[model samples]
Target: MSAQESCLSLIKYFLFVFNLFFFVLGSLIFCFGIWILIDKTSFVSFVGLSFLPLQIWSKVLAVSGILTMGLALLGCVGALKELRCLLSLYFGMLLLLFATQITLGILISTQRVRVERSVQDIVKKTIQNYHADPEDTVAEESWDYVQFQLRCCGWHSPQDWFQVLILRGNESEAHRVPCSCYNSSSANDSAVFDKMIFPQLSRLSPLARPGPSTDLCVVSAKSHIYREGCAQSLQKWLHNNLISIVGVCLGISLFELGFMTLSIFLCRNLDYVYDRLARYR
Candidate 1:
């Protein structure tokens, strides 16, 4: 092959590799989104749904993934087949995707405070209604998981558990302050936090029974439960992962830009007669 032909071949293969990476990345994102949408564990609900559009990050990720994969497929096909029309379509779609990303970045940067406040508000609300029924609601299971994993209680403090009616003076599920509040080793042993099973309970004496033992018991729990809130933890997590996030964004931007340039070059320089004859032979 001539020098020009060799160079064109290199560019074509490079684009193939590029689109392949995007295709894989897009597939992962799409799968993750579907998992979040269908997930019954509610593990993600503890982070609070607010600030972002649609109130669900999973859906957003899923849609973005689909778009990325679709455009990437076009790019792969265009480069491999050396089709000017497909290349043009790929370029246009990439441009649109790039613009959308830029707009989203700007919006997030400008409304940082609102987003933070929204997170705080949502977390607080979830805590107020918090329940530890993992088998039941997603919110409850998620909260239990978070508290257990983080070794923390409540949104801002352990006292947040009191906000729940059943945990308080209510006769329903009394004397229990979520198994998550306890350390993992002792979490399953109900003997630790059991308030109503006092030795005097068998006596049935009013003096021995005492009054609202849960109120004082939960107060002592403040010592064992997590002191930090999920909002604060989430903030730290974002800060810690900021570098990776920025790197991914920059990488995607550069990839799209390269795809656009390469597609344009191939379109402008392609020899229609030679390409047609080569295909037949």
Candidate 2:
């Protein structure tokens, strides 16, 4: 065997190893994606709450990992079979997937931003009304009614109230309504009042119940703040992760295209060498 034969053998072995590595990696990533889609609640409870600003990072990472594994598997198959058609199909699928993700990410980000703005406005109006006439009997009464409903629903303290309040209006004044103010026996009046104003106040509850460290007894702007912050945080978190995943997918697709081109060049060179050697013989 000549030096050229040795080089060809080495190239073949390398492609075989690459194919196996990518096949396993792709399988694992596909499994992980299935897990994410299946146990979404578990993912939200464990990873979502822990990584506040980066909550969506895990999902994006999972997506990118899966896409990369897929591309690698395709490239390996194409190389092993010496099939140009397979290589072309692989590149096409990779590009299509990246484009689809980019489009979806843009749409979701836009919708989320709109929702955050609308929620913020409702919070602002409620706060403005509360503070504009803190001393007025009607205003105080309305504020008390809102606070009572929040507590009944589950808010426990001024701080909890505050979180909800700030979520509505970041700059709104903090009004503390004592628990004594709520009359459970007067269910009719409470129900009517809650129907009128508490809807906005209630909108600000966090997705997760704050731990024991959170003050459950207080009702203040903090509740509003937590609620608003969560909305804003969620949007930011999603955008960041989506951008990363899309970027990675684009990069991997380009890499696969490059590899396919290189493989074609190698095949052509091998064919030319074989033809020339046969003619000389």
Candidate 3:
């Protein structure tokens, strides 16, 4: 192969590699979206239709993933076949994808505060109704997972549960606290106490039971239950991971820009390669 032919071949290989990365990334995103949709154990399932935004976002991810894979195939064929029309279409799609990402980034930056507030409101309301209906096993189990994983009780504090119990005026549920609030080192211990029996048992004696000190259990449990709410924890997490998040976005944007430049260059030089091959024939 001549110098020009070799350069074109290298560019074609780069395009294939770049698109292949996107194909894999898109597939992973698509699979995650599918899991989010079908996984009944997740918090998303609890809210059902009320959580329309998340559901819609998941659908978008799945569709975008499929489109990305298709684009990868188009790019591969164009590079290999040296087809002008296919290359043009691939370039156009890349431009569209770039624009969409930039617009999404801008919108997120501008509306971040509003988005955060809305999320917090949703979280508060969800916690308030953590166990509103006994039939809602989905929501209840979801909350249980959150509390156990985050080591948190209610929205702001355990007092949130107290307020709800007062408003509910249900004697049976009065002293009930989520098993996740327990200080036990083992999850099994907490699981065992998740039932409503603890409150009744405490009422029976209300004194130290020697073995684990039942009277002190509430205090210890409160100690284990995170004092900061989920919203607050989320805020801290975002702050801490801001650098990583920005880096990932920047990497994606740069990756797209690089491929776009390569595609344009290839389109310009495609004819030269074809002419050289024609002469060889």
Which candidate ranks first by lDDT, i.e. highest?
Answer: 1
Q: What local lDDT does model 2 show for residue 53? A: 18
lDDT of 1 at 157: 66
User: What is the C-alpha lDDT profile of model 2 across 39-89, one tens digit per residue?
Assistant: 545544554221121224346656777766777776677656656566566
On TM-score, the candidate that comes out on top is: 3
User: Each model's number of backbone clashes?
Assistant: 2, 30, 0
Residue-by-residue lDDT tens digits, candidate 1, 7-119:
77788888878898888999999988887666523423434321112225578889989988998888888989988899899888878888999999998999999987886
Residue 116 alpha-carbon offset, candidate 1, angstroms: 0.9
- lDDT of residue 112 for candidate 2: 70
Candidate 3 per-residue C-alpha lDDT over 132-199 given as tens digits, one digit per residue, 9 for 90 to 100: 56434345455555665666666667666565542344565344455556545643354344343344
Which scores higher on lDDT, 1 or 2?
1
Judge candidate 2 at residue 218 and give its lDDT: 27
C-alpha lDDT of residue 128 in model 3 = 70
List the candidates ranked by TM-score, beginning with the highest.
Answer: 3, 1, 2
Q: Which 10-residue span in candidate 3 carries the lowest summed lDDT?
A: 212-221
How much lDDT does each candidate structure score? 0.65, 0.49, 0.65
